[model samples]
Target: MEAYNFETAIKPFFWVASDKTFSVCLNAGTYKPEIFEWRKDEGFEGNGYDWASLAKVFLEEKRPDLAEDIRFDPEADMFCAYSENPDKLKEFITGFKETCENELQIQDLFLKAEID
Candidate 1:
């Protein structure tokens, strides 16, 4: 599989811009076998995986804390970005939903998923 670019990150993921604000969970493993199968078939690190860098950059803009590349973490488990700050994550997800339309196109398979 091609390395995920911002434009290609939309597939295999549905922004959980959701209530995980106890902490931000940018991506998580999926249990669905089909997804898992696809992930394995594609050599993905995990299901629901997203290209983490774009997410980090988006969050980096709003975050004021020390940052490191998740890739450097041997223990890194997230498929995208993660944050201890709920508000920052919300801002990131909301920003992606509210913006990025012109910058990306959800994989046609995800076209029906809400962008807003």
Candidate 2:
């Protein structure tokens, strides 16, 4: 058996860049269901609930100073931002990674953390 790491696991997924750029990669998982699905039990339900909308929420929740710069790309099935910020990008990836790790079962998960 072989061990896996974050990059390898996420390599197959696409990333929503801040410049409204859609990175062609692998989609590990949406991690955020509420952003796509607007239902009470399903997840977050409010005025705005898509990726761009959620980005606003995340920005406000995290960076109040930074204005929300987000866009929705149906073709890519992801939300992107107009501003290019490393911290925001890292935060987004971290959130997605953490969610995938917590929600997905080890055996069910495609990406596994390296043992060593």
List the lowest-lDDT window of 10 residues for candidate 1.
107-116
TM-score of each: 0.32, 0.38
lDDT of 2 by residue, 54-93 (tens): 4444445444455443332322443334335545554454
Q: After superposition, which runs of candidate 2 have C-alpha atoms over 4 Å from their true positions?
A: 1-13, 16-49, 65-76, 96-116
Clashing residue pairs, backbone N/CA/C < 3 A, model 1: none
lDDT tens readout by residue for model 1, 1-116 = 87845323543334334454222333444322332333343454433333343344443453334343222111234544444564554445455443334334322222222211
Off by over 4 Å in 1: 1-50, 60-78, 104-116
Which RMSD values do the candidates have, in order?
12.5, 10.7
Count of backbone collisions in candidate 1: 0
Highest lDDT: which candidate?
Answer: 2
Name the lDDT value of residue 115 in candidate 2. Answer: 15
How many residue pairs clash in model 2?
A: 7
Give the C-alpha lDDT of model 2: 0.39
